[model samples]
Target: MSVQEPEARATAVSPLGTLSLHVTGASGVTIDVAQAQVPKLPEGMAVDGVMLICVRLAVQITRESPMRIRATADQDGHPETGEWLESMAFANGAGRLQVAMRDDAWLAARGVAAEPVQYERQGFSQVIHEAPAGTALYVSAAWRIDCATAAGDVSAWFAADLALPA
Candidate 1:
């Protein structure tokens, strides 16, 4: 029997609202995810609707190596009613773990919790705020892992999805 490798996804969530998208990838893949109402930047900086973002991460040890993971969600809001959420996780062969969250712009950190998991450990972090009408949130969910161990190996992944009414 044979198996195929995972591929980067283009679209993740199908919604009845403004249509926010989630792109997921594993191992060494790149995923491009965005909402249908989000305006394209760089060539044309256009801002239209408001947005909310969230992220989570998990770490797994299969070989002899420590794990290092980091997840970040930066939501540039309109300084009144915007919110952002970011989370990260890592499974180092070492018996140690940490989780944290922060605020950006006019928003504040609301909640962050470490998930109770075994083998494949996970961490959850989030932030929320209401931006001043007529502005949107910049959702950025980013993660990274780096560490070493003497027992086995380690693997880390970060994934997230969201919905925003246009």
Candidate 2:
């Protein structure tokens, strides 16, 4: 068995609309991400042993539930959250309930590195935790924006099944 790392999707959205993060990584193909996560070697392939190429991003929105935030619609159709994100949890299998990045840091006090890449964006910083081989991960959250001008809350989420690296 080996490690399988998940790549970011081309596009991610929330219940509010399409999301555009100012900060992003390099193009997928250029990174050879697909080939890196494969469980088995291909025929006729030889040489070096298999190596685990794992990179995980832990994103955490710490606003309280039913929190209030300033938002405006972007051309992409998703609400462009202000300097801060509205949901304590947004779309993506990475979002954990009742758990924030700080909680993972607690492990470090016990001598564990949460392995999350801390990304500071608009309103807050998202904790991205890198998962090693044989570890399964899931992100499930429904993000709704209570836009000040709107009568109803705007909702959205991102979902994906991440397989553990073989």
Candidate 3:
């Protein structure tokens, strides 16, 4: 019997409601994300009056040594609404890794009241465990948005790339 080596994998979820990513120089990497809608609102705010937004991201590196992962958010809103947020870079990591964003300031700036709601970890993915001297991978982040003054949810996948430092 023979054993197989792990390869680098890239995965991500962007605020644009899309999930897309790629891995190069390695193989056998996987990613996953889970999002939840805010079911309740603060005082004087109804589900329709407040927007519930959550972004879940996770990455796992099975191989040893170091690997670089980058996440970015491009485009905002969706087919239904105009772009409300701009694309932003999120993270870069190497080795067994995990990343997420649940800052109150981030939520408040997006028009969501920074009260009465708590964010939680939602999803995760795994990167290849082993790689040669140089390896690169990328994954898009996942995004979930609850529309203000509307009752709905938006989800999609974007694109991202990875690179190994010299």
Q: For candidate 3, lDDT tens digit of each residue in 20-123?
A: 33233233334434333333333443321111122222233233432323332332222221122212322222101112222224334533322211211223
Error of 1 at 72 (Å): 12
Q: Please write out the lDDT profile of model 1 over residues 3-54, one tens digit for every residue.
A: 5433222322221111122222222323334433332333422222222332
Model 2 lDDT tens row, 1-166: 9754323432234344433322232112111112122223234322111111122334321222111111111321222231212222222332221101122343344332343323333222233233222322222223323433222322221111111221
For model 2, what is the error of residue 150's alpha carbon versus the real structure, in angstroms, after optimal superposition? Answer: 9.4
Error of 2 at 50 (Å): 37
Best by lDDT: 3
Ranking by lDDT: 3, 1, 2
Model 1 misplaced stretches (Cα beyond 4 Å): 1-87, 92-129, 143-166
Task: Please list the C-alpha lDDT of all candidates, in the order they appear.
Answer: 0.25, 0.25, 0.27
List candidate 2 segments past 4 Å from native: 1-7, 19-102, 106-112, 115-131, 145-166
Tally clashing residue pairs in candidate 3. 22
In candidate 3, where is summed lDDT lowest over 10 consecutive residues? Answer: 157-166
Ten contiguous residues with the weakest lDDT in model 1: 150-159
